[model samples]
Target: MRRGRVLGALLPLLLLATGCGIRSTDVVEVGDPATVEVAPGAQQGTVLYFISSSSPGGLLPVVRQVDDPSATSSSGTGDDGRSRGKQLALLFMGPSRAERKGGLRSELPMSSDQVSVTTGQEGIRVRLASGVNQLSELARQQLICTVAYERGQGTTVTVLGTDGSIGPARCSV
Candidate 1:
């Protein structure tokens, strides 16, 4: 009985001691995450997230039809011929003029031209000129959520900055 009590007490402490270091993260709500599927019933457009005027700091997704009818691939690339880098470039382009009038805007500190992309089993890795600490958490959230929606809900995305790296993180929303 005594040993069981000790073990039980330690268990809660052990659970509390283990964490990813971030004590808490705000779940930036956007609507349902957009999943780009480029197979036989794939969506014929790309979804880009931007900050909305009404929702101050929240992300708003904007779907733009790609020239390619097949749209994107399940592997996070586009069968439409837009690779991950090209997709990221489109993100850097910001929302369209009509979108801006509707209140969608980007939070990225730099353009896609400032970053390089690579993909493997670990997921997509984006290298940036800014340091990990240099980016605001909101900016990081924007990147993570966009990648998560693009690649799939559970897909892991990592950003490597000149000073450091952030994530192998997934957006819960």
Candidate 2:
């Protein structure tokens, strides 16, 4: 009888504890029901891939406010790359003055004109004026991350060299 009373008391407690197992964080809600709409475009700032000062082999992604394209007068837009090519051009230009002061560097070629970008159904193709195999691993990574950041994470990018060599790579960032 005593055992029965003990179990009866513990049963309710056990049931109560199990009922509270669900956490507020366990549920995920997606999409907003509101009618408010916003324009789709590049964020006010841009992301550029550079070489880390401490680790020369690694890539350092930096976000900076968008500058006037005409100030430098590049080709592609930020990342969208529809109107003008800013992100890729700025990346090829290497780290900005402020960025260099902050200890970031770039392995990309000195001449930004040597690089060209074309978007196709297969994805964006980065045509390098030099041989793709000539690029160091760090340089290749720097190019991949920068273009991928603009195109979208994990997007397919083909690097074409002037020698008619084509290399396939994906953005791991």
lDDT to native, each model: 0.67, 0.67
Number of clashes recorded per candidate: 0, 7
Best by TM-score: 2
- Cα-lDDT of candidate 1: 0.67
Quote the positional error of residue 152 for candidate 1 in Å.
2.0
Candidate 2 lDDT by residue in tens digits, 46-144: 566788857544777777556653332233444334322456677778888988998898877777565567777777788766777777778887777
Estimate TM-scores for all models.
Answer: 0.61, 0.63
**Candidate 1, which ten residues in sequence have the lowest lDDT sum?**
72-81
For residues 1-173, write the lDDT of model 1, one tens digit per residue: 99999999999888878863658778888898787533222366666667775765577666766786333333534322245455566676878888888977776754645656766789778776766767666667677776567567788889888788898888644
Which of the numbered candidates is closest to the native, going by highest lDDT?
1
Give residue 64's error in model 1 in angstroms: 1.9
TM-score of predicted structure 1: 0.61
Question: Model 2 — TM-score against the truth?
Answer: 0.63
